[model samples]
Target: MSSSERACMLCGLVQTEAEFVSKGCANCQSIFDKAGVDTIDCISPSFEGYVGMCKPNKSWCARWLRIDNFHQGLYAVKVDGRLPVDVVDLLPHYIPRDGSHVE
Candidate 1:
């Protein structure tokens, strides 16, 4: 089984992130561009609660998911039911919550 499963708000299914992305997480590639997110693996790691770099000179962290918290990007766009991605290192579209990501 896949290691982790999160419901694709776009597709509305509890599937692996890869499934969501492969199926088209966001309809537009420009979404990533606008967010300045590295499609190849955006952001770095944050050691302190408020310290680290995730998007080139930007301080962020991916450790949120550890607490079931999820992040969303600024350009929260939806296309053909395709869900937008959060946690791009710019700003969160919504409040971080364990409920954001479905298991």
Candidate 2:
């Protein structure tokens, strides 16, 4: 599919012709971009969480996913040559329990 026709993985919003393949739809991408993460990877690990690096300084933001207290996702994170599994675990706490659905 063309970039503009791509859908935002987070919000399912169709991107404008000018915004295909950009982090996400304008709204979701804006939030991710403002997060100041240099690179975002949608990877899966054996554990449970979303792993990637925050750009520029290469900081890691490892986000773990839980469905009703059941671990369900894993992401490998490498930032500035350092690994931070503990920090990534903090993501589950930040995710809203009610709105934690992923598509």
Taking every candidate in turn, the Cα RMSD to the unseen true structure, in Å, is: 14.8, 14.4
Backbone clash pairs for candidate 1 read: 43-54, 44-54, 71-87, 72-86, 72-87, 73-86
TM-score of each: 0.26, 0.27
Mind sharing the TM-score for model 2? Answer: 0.27
Off by over 4 Å in 1: 1-4, 7-13, 26-31, 38-93, 99-103
**In candidate 2, what are the lDDT values of residues 5-96, reduced to their tens digit?**
32223322333434433343333344445444322221111122233222313222222322222122221221112112432343453332
Q: Find the candidate with the highest TM-score and give its number.
A: 2
**Among these predicted structures, which one has the highest lDDT?**
1
